[model samples]
Target chain A: MDATQLIHPLLALALAPLMAGIVNKTKSAFAGRNGPPVLQPYRDLWRLLHKGAVYSRTTSWILRAGPIVSLAAVVTALAMLPFGGTAAPLSFAGDLIVFAYLFGLVRFLMVAAALDTGSSFEGMGASREVTFSALAEPALLLALAALARMAGSPSLSGLLAGAVANPAVSIPVLLLAAAAVGIVLLAENARIPVDDPNTHLELTMIHEVMILDTSGPDLAFAGYAALLKQWAFAALLVGVLVPWRTGVLWADVALALAAMAAVAVGIGVVESTMARLRLVRVPQLLLAAVACAALAVVLVLR
Target chain B: MDFWVNCLVVLIAMTNLRLLGSSRVVSCVHTVAFQGVLLGVLAIVGASGGLAAHGIVLAAVNIVLKGLVFPWLLMRALRETHLRREVEPAIGFGASMLLGVLLIGICLWIGSRLPLPVGVQASPLLVPAALFTLMVGLFMIVARRKALTQVVGYLSIENGITAFGLGFALKEALLVELGILLDAFMAVFVMGIIIFHISREFDHIDAGELSALKD
Candidate 1:
């Protein structure tokens, strides 16, 4: 077993929550408040794991299984991602489809879990999540398709690794793809300008309201899964924006780690600068992203 | 030089689509002006010689007219009208964007198939970008509801013609190129005057409603 192969997964598992911590700390700095420590996410996860879970009699087994299954899907998806110079643990031809669909599965379970709670608010969140994600999915797939065409590779590993090697593709295409993926990253992770993760107001919330029924280890799993999902998407974003390979494993890994941290801070900057978009206007923003990615696609295809 | 030309071409195409997808009239105006400036810069970059005298002159005039002067003139015309967006369009934003994409694809195909003129300095992507811009401009003119937006569309069409002139046509005749610029200046001035009349005659500037009037 190569040491490099283990680097991506281990780093993701250990540092996922740290991303959340960094994001909060950045936001707090922007807001002029001394926020929680950078390790707060880890502490929260630990506390949640230690507490006992309490479920209402009204819920079914789906509620219990939702977080675990979603976490499982995220882990599998993470394994398929190549970070910096470290190759993915499991990458095959057309693994991009599996990577994309595993998130779909996670979404399916999360929505199902939300619906199972019988809370109208969770249902609302579920619907909003589905609607926005439905708009966002084409942009994601189309952007990936653009990358696939440029690289002429169907899998995530080959696509990210070899896409830029093609002299035919230019910086504009990559910049546009990066922009599309950045928007999708923000949208999928329930960040600002799409959905606000920190809002407690039930009417405006999307991701948080859905998880209102979760507690204890289940909540911890969901939170951890979220962090991993963030890490995975951040990895994908880094892969698109920065594909620098030094041929030295440690150097490349360090660069990837730095890129991941930069993505967190970037997210924080975005959240601080822009207000959450109106629900009705969110599709327009996503459509603009689609236009951007589609332009890149056209450029690549041409 | 090639990368800069390619980026400019791509950016011009993007600005055309931005005009299509945008809702607000002012932003659309800004977008077309931005496209105009890009077209000017594209002309300068697409020129073979390094900052030739005519190239500098053409770029300066093009940028001044399209970027600064046209925007100021349009904003002056737009100030009297309370309208800020294209609220009721024949085509919605999403449909317009998709159509713009389809237009680019078709134009790219057509552009690749068409032969580039012999010994002319033009990027392979330039002709298609010009075609795409032209098509989007025409679409905007027809589909948009407001008069100000239609004017933006018209300027976009002229920008397309200007791009084509810089790339595929008028390699020698700076006179003809200047004539084209002067023609657009007059056309915009005339159109602005007409828009003023139309807005004064009617309470709202929705051009589609004008079809109801009979001479």
Candidate 2:
């Protein structure tokens, strides 16, 4: 892989934090408040990395390794993602499966660390996370697998590149897959309608509660990983929605980056306009996503 | 033409979801009314010849009765009953919507298997959309405890039938369509009176409560 292939990772690492900032800015605009500078997330990460690490007496090596493993898993997954139809450096058949489970590995570690804390609160959060992700996993896998079939590719790079290569047949599949992945994105990242990243109330929290014990550089790793995960999901969304592939490497890369920004803005707008669904009702939204994806599969087969 | 109809199909499917998800009485009424207006638009567009006079009259009357008259009657019952909103039971909004999705799949499967009328120009999605709407409407009637929502469900079932008819454009008789509308009006009008009395008798309009009655 050359510099052209490296562009996806370079752009993502540079802009992932900004995606969070953009979400904050849009939400701030909706709330009629001037939010923090768009550079706040970068500043927060820097401050976090410089702080001292703290560990609970009950915690083991599992807790110490949680953030590192999770972040490492996310970065590995990123290696397989294409930028604006540009293939990943590590593209292969069935790499999409590996890509998906790498995040699952992240969740597993996070939940394991949470359990090792021996705190009932984090356990409740982990249980809830597992329950919801259980439902979300099927929809995400179904949507991705169906998209792969529609695009006639078993890998992420070719599946997305195939979509960009042939818009006519792949668009309907993209439309449905996009909806499914969109919900997965929100749910996985702990966004407003799924789990409010902003909420501090322990009773209502899903993801935040799991990370309550982390401190210092570990928290920063966890925080940055969350941002990167958002970027990855947004990239997947942009892959489906923006099928433009100007053959110029720079132009396609630039256009995909711009589309990713648009998606961040869209997420912010959705977060601003809608209140979170009740915990009972979130499954319905995910199910709706499954239906949309299933309908696409039906359309493809029909 | 197929594109516009498919877009309409999407909109109709949305209304079905909205009705399934929304528990507020006024919003449900509005969704049912919107489906009527959509049907009117569907009638004109689904017409074979460019803006036939027969199609225009049918669309106008269909809109006036289904969109205007039926919802107005339901709202009046709503006002008399003083039922602003309701809590759902047996199924949550998510499960209801999931069922709605499953219903769409079933309808798509059924629509695919059922042969179309010879030489009809209906879009491929139209029959499935109509069938899906009908299934949701019926599901709403069975699942919801509120009397008004059940009425909304019943009206949507009518909307589904109207959509199915438009799919064929078998307008050999205009009077038969009007007769069906008149029958629906009578049903809603009578149901409205019954709802008002039920509300006065029990201080609530949950149809499920009627099951508690003793002879």
Candidate 3:
């Protein structure tokens, strides 16, 4: 692959934690406090990597493999995603489905690993994750499908590239699908209005509780993978909302990166502004996303 | 201009969903008021250059009546009733939102099937959005339990009708549109008075609770 293709993956690896840092900084800024350094996540990952591992007696090979597989899946998914205006390194005609299910695989592995611990809290967390993701998955797919149809291409890169090519036709479609995918990003990443990543209460936790038993390097992997997933999804959103392409590879890549950073700030604002929906009401929010995607589909179909 | 029209349409549709999902009576009123103003702006945006004066006057009347007058009347009625929130719904919020989506889909399908008018420069989304808002208002009136919410729903229906009317402004006269607006205002005024009396007399304005006297 050329340098443009290499930039996407390298950016994913290097800047994923920076997104979490930006989010934390934004949240802290909103609360009027000096937060951790912007490089704090990187430092945390470094610390975790050097620490010793502690495994529960009931844990098996599944528990050990969970973080690695989840991270691997996310990395593979990253390879399939186009960074802003750049085509991904490994895109094919049907890679969009593969890109989406790679997350499903991550979820499956995570749930299995959580179940392997045999902890009641982790089991509850796993159940919550499965229930919510099941609702959110359709929204992601339908939104992508709408874009695919509008772009007249089934592949992720082709849809994104095609959307950017036709601004006048794509803006309305983009507005609807962007909102749908934005909600999916927040829900799937355990952000506000779905599940708060920072809440201390175990009973209310969805994602964090699932990894209660994970510590040291394993916890680090999970955290890093979560950040990468956030970046990947945010990239997808930026790709839709910011359709600007300068035709120069470096300029286009820079614009896309800036747009992705703006998305992170937007997420931070949303998290700061809205409280988590009542658990029962989470389905309603997901349904709204589905409604948005469905609307986009209907709009394009007409 | 088409972009602005679509933006307004999106805002109008959002208000429909907001009304469906909102529990607070005052917030519902505010959302409806916001929707009314959006419809006014949409009318101006949707109109062709030839009808600029008609569009502006219609939009101004819309803003005054639905945005200011109706909201003022409803809020006064709400003050008399001392009802701030609608605690019960005939259908739950989540279900109402889902139903709202279904209504929108059906309306959009119908709208797409209908031919666009010969001379109108309106966005194709206008008709479907108008129909969706209309159905959502009707849905609210049916599904909400409070008398105040019903009033809000009725006002939403008026807003929807106004939006629908905008799509036909080329064929319909300015006088007919004004007459419709005045009629809507009077209906909301009458509804507000009746709601105030019901809440004052019965001490609770729950429409569902009013069915006890059917026998």
Top candidate when judged by TM-score against the true structure: 3
Regions of model 3 farther than 4 Å from truth: A162-169, B115-118
Task: Kindly report which residue pairs in candidate 3 clash with one another.
Answer: none
TM-score of each: 0.94, 0.91, 0.95
lDDT tens digits, residue span A1-302, model 2: 57678878877888899999999999999999999888899999999999999999999999989999999999888989998857798889999999889989999999999999999999999998998888888787888887787778899887788454444345556776888899899999999888888998888899999999999999999999989999999998888777668788778888888888888888899899889888887877777777677766766666
Which residue segments of model 1 deviate by more than 4 Å? Answer: A166-168, B85-87, B169-173
Model 3 agreement with the true structure over B1-215: per-residue lDDT tens digits: 77777778877987888888877888898999999999888877788665578788999999988899989998998888887565468999878888887888899889889887687655788889988988888888898888888888888888888888887887455788899888988999898888887787778888876777655
Q: Report the C-alpha displacement of residue B179, candidate 2, in angstroms.
A: 4.3
Candidates 1 onward: DockQ, in order: 0.50, 0.38, 0.50
Q: Rank the candidate models, highest TM-score first.
A: 3, 1, 2
Query: Residue by residue across B32-128, what tens digits does model 1's lDDT show?
Result: 9999999888878888866667777888999999999999999988886655555457998878888887898899999999887688878788899
CAPRI verdict (incorrect, acceptable, medium, high) for model 3:
medium
Q: Where is model 3 chain A poorest over a 10-residue stretch in terms of lDDT?
A: A162-171
Q: How does the DockQ of candidate 3 come out?
A: 0.50
RMSD (Cα, Å) of model 2: 2.8
lDDT string for model 1 (A200-301, tens) is: 999999999989999999999998998999899899989989876888888888998999999999999999999998898788788878888888898887
**Which pairs in model 2 have colliding backbones?**
A284-B94
